[model samples]
Target: MDVRFQTGSKRFNYRAAGILIEQDHVLLHKQVDDKYWALPGGRVKLGEQARDTVVREMKEELGYEVHVDHTPWIAENFFHYDGHDYHELGFYCTLISNQSYFQKGPYHGLEGERLIYQWIPINELNEIVVQPEFLTAGLRRVPEHTEHVIVEN
Candidate 1:
């Protein structure tokens, strides 16, 4: 099961996300009903390495193999969603696509939802609400070193 839980005042999650860049644009999953943009990954399953989780999530979500280049950022994110406060431990990694999936626009989410993939240009990061604020500001060029980030909402 996923390492997620809810208490009276907060919900905690252990999740991993991938940052895939192509043609000077970054890929983000925008749920039709969501208020913020999200990365292309899911909860980090128990007994799985964070890097492996990134690879697995890409395959599960996009139906393609992705190579995890390196850990660009690790974050401890705190935010509010709906009516609940969230505390999330997130792993953000850069992904390398060996070849294209060659699918058309608007792919289906593997987790039983019809999701949409939006390729936002790196320059327009501020146009939308992206969680973990650190990314929207600094995602254009992934850092060469792994860095820990903290976000408080």
Candidate 2:
């Protein structure tokens, strides 16, 4: 049911991502074998609004019920990964959660230990490899208005 399609070495994806920042840190996740981190979210399912995708992914991935605070970016990204050329459309949303356990630094999500989640201090983001690359600097100064970003990597 994910909004993605593949054809002859090319793929297209529709995704929704959430930004959860608390106490000067932002939540990021990556598969156990991956080297880069990305905002916590997943593919947008068919017929689901981007906002709802954020809420659903958080609960499914981290067991946290989140509310969408605001949408900050819609990105169109072109990249090659895992042997496929991909064109991805992503909706970036800010999220708010009342869960206190999330403050405990790093942990694995509800789906076992396949994915690793951590809160990286905002100031130290520049030291890590964040996907889209723009986020390394852009996350430090979230725009007040919704911005459109196009990245080719």
Candidate 3:
């Protein structure tokens, strides 16, 4: 099962996200009704490695097979959403794929229109709302070494 649980009024999650950048653009996705976007990934399943999670999620969500290039960050994200206080541990991994289909334009993911995927120009990230805030600047300059980021929102 996915690594998520609730205790009292707070919920905790362990997620793995992939950062796919190509041709000066970065891939981002969100639920059609949501106002914000985030890297494409999902909760890590039990007994799964983070890298494996990235590869699995990409194929499952985007229909593209990908390999993990490297891990850049392990983020401790805190926030409130849908009335629950959340404590999330996120593994942010850089990804590489041979498929060029996503480079064309915005497309609906395998989940139909509920999830929307788009390649946004990296330079224009300032115009859109990317969650975890740190990623707005972090994606512009990915650190050579893995970083431990604590984001409380």
lDDT of each residue in 38-127, candidate 2, tens digit only: 999999999999999999999998889889998889999999999999999999999887775356666898899998899999999988
Q: For model 3, which pairs clash?
A: none
On lDDT, the leading prediction is 3
lDDT of 1 by residue, 111-150 (tens): 6665677777779889988887888887976899999999
Pairs in clash, predicted candidate 2 = none
Cα-based RMSD of candidate 2? 1.1
TM-score of 2: 0.96
Cα TM-score of candidate 1? 0.90
lDDT of 1 at 76: 95
What is candidate 3's CA lDDT for residue 132? 85
**Prediction 2 global C-alpha lDDT:** 0.91
Q: Would you list the C-alpha lDDT of every candidate in the order shown?
A: 0.83, 0.91, 0.91
